[model samples]
Target chain A: MQINSSMKKSFLFKSLVDYLYILNVGGFLLLLTTISFGFVEINVIKGGDEHWSLLAISISCISVLTCIVFLRGVYYLRKMARHLLTHKYFSKQIIKCLKISGTHFLLAGVMFVVIMILGWIGKLREGLFEFVYDINLMVPLFLMIIGLFFMIQSEALLVAKNFKEENELTV
Target chain B: MPIIINLDVMLAKRKIRSKELSERIGITTSNLSILKSGKAKAIRFSTLEAICKALECQPKDILEYRDS
Candidate 1:
């Protein structure tokens, strides 16, 4: 079908699942780097002191955990898609995860923007530099945030339905 | 809020089995049962349309309106 990529038949959930999985693993790596090397390097390269380093570490922890949760949700989504006629506990989990991850991505985006602004403003206060980021980098982040919102909405709709369909099928 | 699905009535009138209707409608027998039992929360326009077409009736033939 022309809409396969946009439909459940094409297993679109795999994309979100992949994103969450990557985020989890990448976050863990970042956490490791921050602890093992970035801690030392940031002070030299970015002029970010130990406090910034610690905050980076904390955010990494939060993101890694969130990504893991979202990835677990991915498993449930795939399961539900494959078993359209079964109403089980895992189905409920999929819906719950959709709601959580949807909100999670949006929140993460907001937090990122806030932290970037604060980081820039903090630099401005020091009179050392101004915030000068290429527009390209910021565009993707905003687009990603918007995509997460729509994904969450659409996935949640799929989850809410079919209980009745499953019920009919089972009976 | 009181939209009654008249699938049962139509099936009774036609002397058809749920399994037969499901087969015709391309759904599992259990799901057809669920629809007949009024346990379904929502039905797709396509599925409902198929049922209506197969039964040779309008949606109102299978779905009724009442003040709830």
Candidate 2:
């Protein structure tokens, strides 16, 4: 009974899931505001230039899409965390959630990289490309690594599930 | 799958209910049911001993081999 309670309230996963939820909402709102600002700049202000408006709109559109994909990943992570909280360490739902989360994260990472590349190319064409390195490059790279890790963890958990079943059946 | 547990038979012979036997052997009713239903992968010697003592029977009386 004590174990069940502790498992049900595992603070680490609970906190992590909560943090992810905040991040998801914040990211979505930020992207929406950016898109709104882009439109306002283009339509409301006659003095505003076209290039920044267009760039902002395009970037925000792409970001909104990526955020949606990333939201899916976060959703699965929350589901997975719920299962973990219930002490269901080796179940089909967890494996499926992990797999889905991994795919979404991988897709989001790839899309983000593409967006950055396109932006970089646009700047280069405009002769505005900077030579300095951008730390923002690490975000997508880390996301991809996390996706791969989740995939690998799911596979590892698959094998562990078999062992767990075998152990459970042992009288 | 080939190894069968005949704990139900022994329980019947001993006129003991599953809940009673589980209590006597200090195991959960679900685990006892698993043993009786032949779903258990393996039985520990200690559990076998406890069951044997509770039912006043040998391990052979509680376990059997089947071709299927």
* Best candidate (score: DockQ): 2
Off by over 4 Å in 2: A1-16, A33-62, A82-95, A120-132, B13-29, B49-68
Q: List the residue pairs that clash in candidate 2.
A: none
Q: i-RMS, every candidate?
A: 4.5, 0.7
- lDDT tens digits, residue span B1-68, model 1: 47677899998888888888888889887778777877776788888887887788788888888888
What DockQ does each prediction reach against the true complex?
0.16, 0.64
Question: After aligning candidate 2 to the native by TM-score, how far in Å is the CA of A163 from where it should be?
Answer: 3.2
TM-score of chain A of each: 0.52, 0.77
Query: Ten residues in a row with the worst lDDT in model 2 chain B?
Result: B33-42
Cα error, residue A109 of model 2, in Å, equals 1.6
Best by TM-score: 2
